[model samples]
Target chain A: MTFKLFSEHLLIVVAAEVLALAVGLPLGVLCYFSPKARKPILWVVDVLQTIPALALLGIIMVLAGAGKQTVIIGIALYSLLPIVQNTNLGLLQVDPGVKEAACGMGMGRMYRLIHVEFPLAFPVVFTGVRIAAVNAVGSAVFAAFVGGGGIGTAIYKAIRIQNMNMLMQGTATLMAIAIALDLSMGWVEARIKRGHSSMKKAPARRN
Target chain B: MIKFEHVSKKFGKKQVLDDMNFEIPDGQFVVLIGLSGCGKTTTLKMINRLIEPDEGRIYIDGKDIEKVDKVELRRQIGYVIQQIGLFPNMTVAENICVVPKLLKYDKESRDRIVHEMLDMVNMPYDEYAHKYPSEMSGGQQQRIGVLRAFAASPPIVLMDEPFGALDPMTRETLQDEIKKLQKKLNKTIVFVTHDMGEALKLADTIIFMEDGKIVQMAPPETMLENPANDNIRRFLGKHMNDDAVTLTVEDFMRTNIITVDKHRGVRECTERMARTGVDTLLVVDESDKYIGTVSIKDIRLRGKNEKLIEALITDNAKTVRRDGDAHECFDHLLNSGDNYVVVLNNDDTIAGIVTKNSMAKALSDTLWGDER
Candidate 1:
C-alpha cells in the first residue's frame, strides 16, 4: 500500500516536470532572441512563483476543477521560473569568443544557434530543469488537497486519526523519494559537467 | 585578387574605415598593421563581407563582392582570429575538416586533407587526429587552428593577429611555419597584426594604417629605408635592425681568392696560396661547391707531398648568403673572431668570401663613389 502511494506521487512529479520543460524551453528561447518579450514573460513567471503553491493549485482548480489535471498544471506553473530563467541564462552565458568563431567559419545564424550555441548552453540549462524536477517532487504531495491520490492521502489520514505509525511510514517514504530524486539528478548533473570539461582543449595561452 | 575602392564605414560617430582604397594582387602575403581601433581588422572583414561598407564597393577577382552571397563568399575564403578559438568539443581532425565538410567533399578527400594539413606542421595524423582540443597545449592548438583554415585549400586566407596570444618563442616558430606554408600553398594571405617584427618577417607588402586610413603601403625593406612621414617613422620604432643605410653580404664580399680541389695535393694548395698571396685556400669537392678551407699555417704544420689537400682541411667553413641582412652576419663574424665567412649562392655553391679585405673595399667604394 505504501509502495503504491509513492508510485502515484512519482508519476505526478514526472508528469508536471515534463509539461513544464516542454512549455518553458521554447518560451525561454523566445525570450533569449527577443529582448522585448523577455521582460514581460519573466515578470509573469515571477508573479506565479510568489503565490503559495497550495493557493496556486486552489486557484488553478477554479478553472480546470479539482483532479490530477489541476495538480499537474499547478506543479508545472510553479516549475516554470527555474526552467525559463536557466534557459535564458544558459543561452546568454555562452562564451562570446566561441560565438564569434562560429560566425567567422561561415555558419549561418540558425545553424549556429542549433548546433553551437544550444549545445554549449545545455549543461547550464539542464541545471534549471534539475532544480525544477526536485522542487516538483516536493510540491506534488499537495495533490491530495484536491483529491488527487498520492502519499499525501496517507499522511493526511494518519494525522486525522492520530496514528503515529502510519504517519512515520508516509513521512519516511516521502523523504526517501526526495533523496532518490535528488541523488539521481545529481548524477545526471555530474555527467554533463564531465562532458563539458572534456570538450574544451586547455584555455588559450596568453602572451 | 582583392580590390577595395573608396570604401567608408562609421561606427556611431567614429569613422572606422575611411575611403579605404587599395588592390592586393594574387598570391601576395600582405600584412595590415596599426594601433588598436584603427580599422586594420575592419578592412579584412569587408573582404568577406562580415562588415559591409557604408559606401563604395569591394571586388574579388573582377566580381563585385556586394553581388556575391555572403555565405558563399566566406566559404571560399579562410579566416583566423586572434584567440585561436578551436572548438573544445571537437577532435583536431574534426575541427580541420569543418570547412571541407561544409563544402560537401567526399569522406576520402576530407580524411586525406586532415592528414595533409597535420603533416605540414609536423603533427602526425595518428597521434593528433583524434585528440580533443583540451588535450593539447596552447601552441599545439593554435597550430591546429591554423591548419583548419588551410584545410579546404581556399584561394585566399585572412588572419587577424592569429598568433598574438602565444609566447615569443612559440609565436616565432608559428611565424616561420606560416611563411613556409604560404610559400608552399601559394595562397594569397592577408594578415593583420600590431607587431612590427612579425610584419617585417612575413609580409611581402605591409599596409600601415592610422586613423582609419592607410598611411603607407610598401614592402618591408622599402618602408624601413624610407618612412613616408614622421608618424610612420615613429610607428616603425627604433628597432636596431632597420635604418636609412642598407647593407647586405653582397656589399662586402670578395670574389678573388684561392680555389683548390680536395683531391689536389698539399703542395698544389700551398702553391695556390702563394700565387694568390693569401693565407687561406678554399677546398671544394668535384661539384666545385666549398666543403672546407686549408690555411697556410695548417699546410706548414701538416704538409706532405703525397697527401691530398683534403687532409689539411680544418672543416672551419662558415657560410652566409649574399642577400642576408648585414648586421646579423657582421655580429656573427665579430663574435666568432673569424676573418672569413663564405658567401654562398641560393643553391649553396660558394660565391666568394666576406673578409676584412672585402669590408675595406666596401668602405672604399662607398667613400669614393660619394666623393665622385
Candidate 2:
C-alpha cells in the first residue's frame, strides 16, 4: 500500500512540474518583453498567490470537476508569481552597454536578445524557476486532500486512521525529494554563473 | 566628409544642444574643445545616431545619415569613449575585431586586421590580444579602445576624451602615438578633448564650443594669434606665455656678432670690430666651429702683429645653445659674472651672442608694457 502511494505521489509531482514549466516560461518571456502587459498580468498572478492552497484546490476542483487536473492547475497558478517577476527583473537588469554595443555592431534585435541578453540573464531567471519548482513540490501535497493523488494522500490516509508509521514514510519521502531538487537546482545555477563569469574573463577574440 | 546641418537637440525642456552647424572635411584631424556641459560629447553621439537630433540633419559622404541603416552605418564608423566601454566578456583581440566580425569579415582577414590595429596602437598583438580589459591598465585599455575603433580601418573615427582618464604622462605619450597613427592612416578623425594643450597639439583645426554653440573654428595658430571674440580671448588667456620658450631665442639672438680664426691679425680684427661698433667678436675657424671670442680692448693693448684671436681672446666665455630659452640667456647673463655669452648651434657653429644689455631688454619686453 505504501509503495503504491509513493509511486502515485511521484508521478503526480513530476507531471505538475512539467506542466508549470511549459506554461510559465513563455508567459514569463512575454511579460518581460511587453511592458504594457506586465503589470496587469502580474497583479492577477499576485492575487492568485494570495488564495490559500487548500481553498484553491477546493475552488479549482469545483470548476474543473475535481481530481489531479484541478490540483495541478491550482499549483501551477501558485507558482507563476516568482517565475514571472524574476524573469522580468533579470532581463531588465542586463547591462545596457552590452546591448548598445551589440546593436551598434549591427546585431538584430533577435540576435542581441539570444546571444547577449538571454545568456547574461539566465542565472537570475533560473533562480526564479527553482523557487517555483520547490513551491510546486510543497503545494503538490495539498492536492491529496482533494483526492488529486500524491504523498499528500498517504498523509491524509494516515491522519484518517491514526497511522503514524504511514505518515512518517510519506512525509519523509516528500522532504527528501524537495531537498534533492533544491540542491540540484542550486548546482545548476552555480554552473551557469561560473560559465558567465568565465566568459567575461575571456578576452574577446575577433572572428 | 561629415556635415552637421543646423542640428539642435533637447532633452525634455532643457536645450542640451542649440542649433549647431559645422562641416568636417575629409582626412582632417578636427578637435572640439570646450568645458564640461559644452555638448561636445552630445555632438559626437549624434553622428552615430546614439542621440538623434530633434531638428535638422547630419550627412556623411553627402548623404543624410538618417537615411542609412543605423546599425550598418555605425559599424562602418568607429567610436571610442572616455570610459572605453570595452566588452569585459571579450578578449583584446575580440574587442578589436568586433566591427569587422559584425561586418562578416572572414576569420583570417579579421585576425590579420586585429593584429595590424593592435600594432598600430602600440599594443603588440601577442602580448595584448589575449588579455582581458580588466587585466590591462587604464592607458592600455584606452589604447585598445582606439585600436578597436580603427580595427576595420574605418574612414572616419570619433573619439570622446579617449585618453582623459589616463595619467598625465600616459596621456601625453598616447596623444603623441595617436597623432602619429592618424598621420599615417590619414583617417578623418573627430577628437574631443577638454584640455586646451592637447587640442593645440593635435588639431588641424579646432572648434571652440560654448553653451552648445560653436564660438570659433580655426587652425591652432590663428586661434592663438587672433581669437574671435572676448569670450574666446579670455578662454585662450595669455597663450603667448605657454608658447614654448625655445621660440623666443630667435627674437633675443644677436645677428651682428662677428667671428675670427685664431691666426687672424689684431689690427684687421680691431678694424672689423670698430667698423661694426662692437667691442667683442667670436673667434671661429673657416668651418664656423666656435673657438673663442676677442675684445676690441684686447686688440688695442696686444700688438697688431700678434694673433689677437688666440693671444688675448677669452677662451672660457660662457655660452648657450641656439635652442636655449630667452629666460636661460637672461639667467646666464645675470649670474655668470661675465658681460656676454656666446651661443652655439648643434654643430658647434657660432649661432649668435647674448650680452647683459640684450638679456635685460628681452626680459623687460616680456615683463613690461610694449609702450615703446
Candidate 3:
C-alpha cells in the first residue's frame, strides 16, 4: 500500500515538472529577448508562486472538477517560477565575449541562443530545474485535498483518525522522495560541471 | 575598398565618431590605433554594421553597406577579438566551422575547410580538431579563433586587439604569423590595437585616432619620421630613435627573427630556414626560454643522423641583454666573428636578433630624416 502511494506521488511530480519545463523554457527565452514582455511575464510567475499550494489547488479543482489533472496543473504552475527565472538568469550570465563573438560571426538571434548561449547557460538552467523538481515533490502532497490520490491521502486520513503509524509512513515516504529527487538531479548537475572543468588546465605553453 | 562618407555617431551627448571620412584601399593591412575612448573600435564595428552610424553611410567595394543585410555582410567579413571568445561547448573543428555552417556549406566542404584552416597554423587536424577550447592553451585558442574568422574566406578581416591578452613572446609569434597570413591571403585587413609596436609591425597603413577623430593616417615609417602632433610623438616615445643619445639594444634589434623549437625535426628546421631565408634559427625549449642557436651549417655537418634539432643546438653565438647599450652591442657585434648578436630578455627568452643589416637600417633612418 505504501509502495503504490509512493509511485503515484512520483508520477504527479514528474508529470507536473515536464509540463512546467515545456512552458517555462520558451517563456524564459522570451523574457531574455524582450525587455517589455519580461516585466509582466516574470511578475505573473512570481505571483503564482506566492499563492499557497493547497489554496492554489483548491481553486484549480473548482475549475477542473477535482481530479489528478487539476493537481498536476497546480504543481506545474508552482514550478514555473524557478524554471523561468533560472532560464532568464542563465542566459544573462553567459560570457559577454562569447555572445559578441556569436553576433560578430553572423549568427542570427535564434541561432546564437540555440548553438552558443543556451549550451553555455545549460548548467545554471539545470540547477533551476533541480530546484523546481524537488519543490514539486513536496507540493504534490496537496493533491489529497482535491481527490487526486497519492501518499497525501494516507497522511490526511492518518491525521483525521489519529493513526500514528499511517502518518509516519506517509510523511517518511514523502521526505524520501524529495531527498531522492534532489540527490539524483544534483548528481546530473555535478556531471555537467565536471565535464567543463576536467580539461580546464591553464592554456598550453608556447613552444 | 571600404569608404566612410561623413559618418558620425553619438552616445547621448558625447560624440563617439565625428563625421569620420576615410577610404581603405584593397588588400592593404591597415591598423587603427588610439587611447581607450578614441572610437577606433567603434569605427571598426561600423564596417560590418554591428553599430550603425547616426548619420552618413559606409561603402564596401563602392556599394553602400547600409543596403547590404547586416548578417550577410558580417558573414562575408572576418572578425577576431582579444578575449579569444571561442565557444566552450564546441570542439576546435566546430568552432572553426561556425561561420561556414551558417552559410550552409555541406559536411564534406566544411571538413575540408576545417582541415585546411588548422593546417595553416601548423596544428594537425587529427589532434586539435576534436579537442575542446578549455583543453588548449591561450595561444592555441587564439590561433583557432583566427582560423575560425578566415575559414569562410572573407575578403576583409577585422581584428580588435586580438593578441592583447597573450604574453609578449606569444604575442610576437602570433603577430608574425598573422602578418604573413594577411599578405599571403591578400585580404584587406583592418586591425585595431593600442600597442604602437604591434601597429608598426603589422600595418602597411596606420590610422591614429584621438577624441573620436582621425589624428593622422600614413605609412608606419612616415608616421614615425614625422608624427602629426605632440600626442603622436609622445605615443611613438622610445621608438623615435632620433631623440636618443644612448639607445638600447631593443631599438636596434629586428624582432622578425625565425625561431625553432628544440624538439622539431631536422627537416622541418631546414625548411623553415630556407623559406624565411635565415641561416641561423634561435632555439628555445618547451618553456620558450632561449637555449642556444641552431645553424643550417651545423645541421648539414652533424645533423645527418640526428632526428631532432635539439641535438644540433650550440651556444657558440654571441648574446646580449635587451637593455644593453646599443653602441657597446654594436661594437661587440663588429669585434665578434658572429653574424648577429641574439638579444635576450631578462628571463632569457629571445627578444630579437641585432644583425648588421638591422643596425644599418636604423642608422639610415636616423641620417635620412624624412626620407625612407
Candidate 4:
C-alpha cells in the first residue's frame, strides 16, 4: 500500500511539473523576445499567482469536479510562476555581446537562441524548474483531500483514527522524497554550472 | 576599397557624425584616431551597417553597402572589438571557425582552417586549439579576437581599439605582431584607436576625427609634420614626440674616437686620457676593433708597476641601437635597472652614451616645444 501510494504521488507531481514547464517555458521565451507582449503577459501571470493556493484548489475542485484532473490543474497553475519567471530571466540575462557576436557570425535567430542563448541561460532556468518541482510535489499531497489518492490518504486516515504513528510515517516519507529530489537537482545544477564555466573559459585560453 | 561619402549620423536631436567623407585604398592600413566620443568607433560600425548612417552612403569595393545583404557583407569582412566578443560558449577552435561554419564549410576544411588560423595568430594549434577563452589572459583573448576576424580570410578587417584593454607591454607587442601580419596578408584594414601613438606606429594613413567629422586624412608622416588646423594640431599633440622618441642606436652613434691598446702602461694611458679629458677610454684589439673601456679609477686601483693590460678590467656595458627613439631609450633605462646606456651603431659598435639626464632633457624639450 505504501509503495503504491508513493508511486502514485511521484507520478502526479512529475506530470504536473512537466505540464507546467511545457506551458511556461515557451511563454517565457516569447515574453523575452517580444517587447510588445511581455508587459501584458506578465501582468496576467502576476494576477494568477496572487490567488491563495487553497482558494485556487477549492475553486478548481468545484469547477472540474474532485479527482486527479482537478488536483493536477490546481498544482500546474501554482507551478507556473517560478518556471515562467525563471525562463524569462534566464533568456534576458544572456550577454548582449555574445548574442551580437553569434549573429555577426551569420547565425540566424533560431540557431543563435538554441546554441548561444539557451546554453547560457540553462542554469538560471533550471533553478526555476527546481523551485516549481518541489512546490508541485508538496502540493500533490494535498490532492488526497479531493480523493486524488496518494500518501495524503494515509495521513487523512490516521487523523480520522487518531493514529499518530501513521501520520508521522506519511509525513516523514513525503519530507524524505522532497529532500532527495532537492539534492538530486542540486547535483544536476552543479554539473550544468561546471559545463558552463568550462565553455566560458575556452576562448580565453586561446589568447 | 571602402569609401564614406558625405556620411552623417544623428541620434534623435544630437548629431554624432557630421558630413564625414573619406576613402580607404585597397590593401591600406588606415587608422582613425581621436578622443573618446569622436565617432571613430561609429565610423567602423557604419561600414558594416551595425550602425546606420542618417544620410549618404558607404561603398565597399564598388557597390553601396546598403544594397548588399548585411549578414553576407559582415561575413565577408572581419570585425574585432576591444571586448573581444568571442562567443563565450564556444571553444577556441570553434570561435575561430565561426564564420566558416556559418558559410557552410565542410567539417574537415573548417577544422583544418581553425588550426591554420590559431597558428597564424601565433597560438600554436597543439597548445591552444582546444583551450577555452577563460583560461587565457587579456592579451591572449585580444589576439584570438584578431584571429577570429581574419579566420575567414576576409579581404577587409575592421578593428575598434582591439588592443586597448591590454597592458602597455602587451599592447606594443601585439601592435608589432599585427603590423607584420598586415604586411604579409595585405588586407584592407580600418583600425580605430584613441591612442595617437598607436595610430602613428601602425597607420599607413591617418584620419583625425572630432565630433564625428573627419578633420584631416593624410599619411601619418604628413599629418605629423603638417597638421591642418588648431584642432588637428592639438589632436596630434601626444604623438608629436613619437618621431624623436623612436630614435635607433644608429642615430646617436659616434665613430671617431681616442683609444688605447691592451699593452699600454697606466702612465701612458693617463697621458692619452689627460689629452682627451674623457672619464673612460675605449680599449682596442690589434685590428683596432672595440674591446672594452678603461676608467681612471681602474688604473689607480692597480699599482703603476703592474702591467696596465693585466690590470685593466672588461665589463659588459649596456648598448642601444642607433635607430632607437627616446621611448625605446627610456624603456631600456627602466628595464636595465641602470642609470645610463651606450647607444650602438648599425654595425653593433659603440655610438654614444644616453644618460638618464639626456632622456629627461629630451622629453622636457619636446613637451615645452609642443606647448607653443
Candidate 5:
C-alpha cells in the first residue's frame, strides 16, 4: 500500500519538474535575448510565486476539473519560478572574458552562445532544477486534496481516523523520501560543481 | 607586399589613423610603435579587417583587401592580441588548430600541425596539446596563442602587444621564439607595441607615430640616429641620449681620411702610408671609391714600382655601416689585429674611419662629462 502511494507521489513530482524545465528554459532563454519580453515574463513568474500554493491549486482545479491533470499543472506552475529565474541568471552570469575569447576566435553568435556561454552556465542552471525538485516533494502533497491520490491521501486518512500506527507510518514515509531525495540531489549538485573547475565554489578536485 | 594608400579611420570625434600611407615589403618584420592612443594597433587591425579604415584602400600583394571576404582575410592573416584570446574551454592543441579547422585541413594534418607548432615553441606536443588554457601559466598560454596564429602558415601575421602582459623573463623568451619563427618561416609580420625596447629589438623597420600620423618610418639604427622632430626626440628620450649616441660608430668616426686609388703605384702608396704615420692605406679605384686595404708588408714583397696597389690589396678588410653600434665595432677591433673598420654611408661611399683610439676618446669624453 505504501509502495503504491510512494510511486504515485514520485511520478507526479518528477513529471512536474520535467515539464517546468521544458516550459521555463525556453521562456528564460527568450527573456535573456529579448529585453521587451524580459520585464513582462519575469513579472508574471514573480506574481505566480507570491500566490498561495493551495489557492493556486484550487484555481487550477476549477479550470482543469481536478485529478492528476490539475495537480500536475498546479505543481509545474509552482516550480516555474526557480527554473525560469535561474536559467536567466545563469546565462547572465557567464564571464564576459570567456565570451570575448570565443567571439575573437571567430565563433559566430549562435555558436558562441550554445557551445561557450550555455556550457559555462550549466552548473548554475542545474542548481535551480535541484531546488525545484526538493520543493516539489512538499507541493505534490496538495494533489490529495484534489482527489489525485498520492502519499498525501494516506497521511490525510491517518489524520482523520486518529490511527496512531497509520499516521506514524505515513509521516515516516514522507520524511524518509524527503531525506533520500535531498541526499541524492545534493550528490548530483556536488558532481555538477566538480565538472566546472573555474567556478568559485567548486569543491577541491579529486586526484 | 602590403600597402596602405591614404588610409584614415575615426572613432566618433577621435581620429585614429589619418591619411596614412605606407608600404611593407614582403618578408620584412615591421613594428608600429607610439604612445597608447597613437593608433599603432588600429593600423595593424586594419590589415586583417578587424578595424576597417573609414576611407582609402589597403592592398596586400597588389590586390585590394576590401574586395576580399573579411572572414577569409582574417583566417589568412594570423592575429595575436594582448588578451591572448585562447578560448578557456579549448585545449592548447584545439586553440592552435582553430584557424586550420576553419580552413578545413584534414584531422591528420591538423593534429600534425598542432604537434609541430608546440614543438617549435619548445613546449612538448604530448605534454601541452591536450591541456586546457587554464592549466598553463600566462606566458605558456600566450605561447599557445602565438602558435595558434602561425598554425595555418599565413603569409602575413599581425601581433598587437601580444607579450605586453608577461613578466620580463617570459617576454624575452617568447620574443626570441617569435624572432626565430619569423626567420625560419620568412613570413611578413606587422607587430604593434608601445614598448620602445621591444620595437628596437624586433623590427626590421619601426614606424613611429604621433597623433595618428607616421612621424618617421626607418630602421632601428636610422630611427635612433635621426628622429623626425622634437616630439620624436622627446619620445626617443633616454634611449637616443646616452646609450645609443655614445655607443654608435658614427659619432666616433674620423670624417677626414685619404683613400689611395687601387691602381696607384706601390711606391706612391708606401710614401703616403709613411707620411700619414700608418703602415697601411685604404685601396680604392680610379673613381675615388673604396676597394680594400694594402699593407706595407704586401707592398714591399711585391716591390716592382709598376705593380698596382690593387695587386697588393687584401679583400678581407672589414667594413661597418656609419650608423651601426660602436660597441659592435669595438668588440670586433678588440678581437682582431685590424686597426680600423671602414664606415660607409647609405650610398656606400666612405663616411669615415673608426679605429680603437677614436671610439675610446669619444667614450672617455662622455664618461668624464658624466663625472663633471
Candidate 6:
C-alpha cells in the first residue's frame, strides 16, 4: 500500500515538473529577450511561490474542479519561480564576450540562443530544474486536501484516526522520497556542471 | 571600401562621434586609435550595426548600411574583440565554423574551412579540431577567435583591440599573424586600439581621434614625421624622446625584426620572409645567438639545392653593438652597399635591425622637432 502511494506521488511530481518546464523555459527566455516582460513575469511567479501549498491547491481545485489536475496545476505553478528566475539569471550571466561574438557572427536571435547562449547557461538552468523538482516532491503532498490520491491521503487518514503506525510510515515514506530525489538530481546536476566547466554558478533564488 | 558621411552619435548627452567623416579604401589596413572614451570603439561597432548612428549613414562598398538587414550585413563583415570572445561551448573547429554554419555551408566546405583556418595558424586540424576553448591557452583561444571572424572569408573585418588582453609576447606574435592574414586575404581591415605601437606596426593608415573628432589621419611614417598637435606629440612621447636624447643604435633600430632559426628549412625561411614582408632574415643558433643573415636573392640563386638555411647563411650584413654610435651606423648604412645592419646585445643575441628606412626616420625626427 505504501509502495503504491509512493508511485502515485512520484507520478504527480513528474507530471507537474514536465508541465512547469514546458511553460517556464520559454517564459524565462521571453523574459531574457524582452526586458519589459521580466519584471512582471518574475513578480507573478514570485507571488505564486509564496502561497501556502495547501492553500494553493485549494484555490486551483476551485478553478480546475478537484482531482489530480488541481494538485498538478498547483504544484506546477508553485515550482515555476525557480525555473523561470534561474533561466533568466543564467542567460544574463553568460559571458558578454561570447554573446557579442555571437551577435557579430550574424546569428539570429534564436540561432544564438540555441547554438551559443543556451549551452553556456545550461548548467545554471538545470540547477533551477533540480530545485523545482525537489520542491514539487514536497508540494505534491498537498494532493490529499484536494482529493488527489497519493501518500498524502494515507497521511491525512492516519492523522484523523490517530493511527501512529500509519502516520510514521507515511511521513517516513515522504522523507525517503524527498532525500532520494534530491540526491539523484544532485548527481545529475554535478554531471551537467562537469560538462560545462566554464559555467558560472547559478544566481541565488528565493523560495 | 567603407565611407562614413557625417556620421554622428550621442550616448545620453555626451557626444561620442561628432560628424565623423572618413573613407577606408579597399585592401587597406586602417587602424582607428584614440584614448579609451574617444569613440574609436563606438565608431567600429557602427560599421557592423551593433550600434546605429543618431544622425548619419554608413556606406559599405557604396551602399548605405542602414538600408541593409543588420544580420545579413554582419555576416558579410568579420569582427574580433579584445576579450577573445570565443564560445566556450563549441569545439575549436565548431567555433571557427560558426559563421559558415549560419550561412548554410555544406558539410564538406565547412570541414575544409575548419582545416584550412587551423592550418593557417599552425594548429593541426586533427589535434585541435575537437578541443573546447577552455582546454586551450588564452593565446590559442584568441587565435581561434580570429579564425572564427575570417571563417567565411569576408572581404572586410573589424577588430576592436583584439590582442589587448594578451600578454606582450603573445600580442606581438598575434599581431604578426593578423597582419600577414590581412595581406594574404587582401581584406580591408578596420582595427581599433589604444596602443600606438600596435597601430604603427600593423596599420597601413592610422586615424587619430580625440573628443569625438579626427585629430589626424596619415600613414605611420607621416604621423611619426609630422604629428598634428600636442596631444599627438604626447601620444608619441617615448618614441619621440628616444630620437631626441641619444644618438645610438638602440634609438634608431627597428625592434620589430623577424628572425629564423639556423636549422630551419629553406622553404620555411622563405615563407617566414614572405609573411613578414622582409627580404632578409637573421639566422640564430640553437642558443638564439646571432649567426648571420640570409637573403631572398641568395635563396633564389643558390638555395635551390640547399635544404636548410644554415648552409645558405651569409656574412654580407654588418653587425653592430646595441650601444654603437648612431652616426657611425648611419655612415656605414650609406657607404656600405648592405641593405641593413644587425644590432646585437652584449650576449651576442640579435637586438634589432637598422635599415635605411629607420635611419631616415631618425634623421627626419632630428631635423623636424615634434612641434610642426
Top candidate (DockQ)? 1
Residue-wise C-alpha lDDT for candidate 6, range A1-207, written one tens digit per residue? 367788899999999999999999999999999999999999999998788887887777888998999999998898899999999999998888789988987999999999888888888899999999888887788898888889999999999999999999898888888889899989988998887864332211111
In order, what lDDT does every prediction score? 0.86, 0.80, 0.90, 0.80, 0.83, 0.89
CAPRI classification of candidate 3? acceptable
The model with the greater DockQ, 4 or 5, is 4
Q: CA lDDT of B171 in candidate 4?
A: 92
TM-score to true structure, per model: 0.84, 0.73, 0.79, 0.76, 0.73, 0.79
> How many clashes does each candidate structure show, in the order listed?
4, 8, 2, 33, 1, 0
Name the candidate, 5 or 6, with the larger DockQ value. Answer: 6
Candidate 2 clashes between residue pairs 3 or more apart in a chain or in different chains: A9-A150, A203-B90, A203-B91, A204-B90, A204-B91, A204-B94, A205-B94, A206-B94
- In the range B128-246, model 2's lDDT, one tens digit per residue, is 88987778877787788888888888899988787877888888989998899899999999989888888888999999998889999998877876777777666677564544233
- Which scores better on lDDT, 4 or 5? 5
Chain A TM-score values, per prediction: 0.93, 0.88, 0.93, 0.91, 0.89, 0.93
DockQ of 3: 0.28
For candidate 6, lDDT tens digit of each residue in B1-372?
A: 999999999999999999999999999999999888999999999999999999988899999999999999999999998877788777888889888988999999999999899989999888899988888777888898899999999999999988888888988999999999998999999999988899988999999999888999998767876889889878877665443344679888989888888989999988988888988889899999999889999999999999998999988788899998786898898988867899999999999999999888776776796454
Cα error of candidate 4 at position B217, Å: 1.3
lDDT of 4 by residue, A9-96 (tens): 8988888888888888888888898988888877777787889777887898899998888778878887788888888999998867
Pick the winner on lDDT between candidates 3 and 6: 3
The superposed Cα distance between candidate 6 and the true structure at residue A86, in angstroms, equals 0.6
- Model 3 ranges off by over 4 Å: A198-207, B243-372
What local lDDT score does residue B74 receive in model 5, on the 0 to 100 scale? 76
lDDT of 1 by residue, B1-372 (tens): 999999999999999989999999999999999989999999998888889999988999999989998887887898888777777666888889878887899999999999899889999889999998888877888888888888999999999899998888989999999999999999999999998889988999999999889999999888888888777777778642344766889888888766788998877777777787889888888988778888989888878544787778887767888898776777777888898888888876788888877777786877676454
Q: Label model 2 with its docking quality class.
A: incorrect
Between prediction 3 and prediction 4, the one with superior lDDT is 3
Q: Hey, what RMSD does candidate 5 come out at?
A: 7.6
lDDT tens digits, residue span B1-372, model 4: 898999999988778999988889999999998888889988988888888999999998889999998788889989887777777777789888888888888999998888777777668888887877777787887788788888888999999888877889989999998898899999999999988889989999999988988888998867877787777777678666445233444433345566677778778788788888876777766665566777777777764667665467565656666666556667777788865666655665556667666666555655586354
C-alpha lDDT of residue B267 in model 4: 80
Instruction: Say which prediction, candidate 2 or candidate 4, comes out ahead on DockQ.
Output: 4
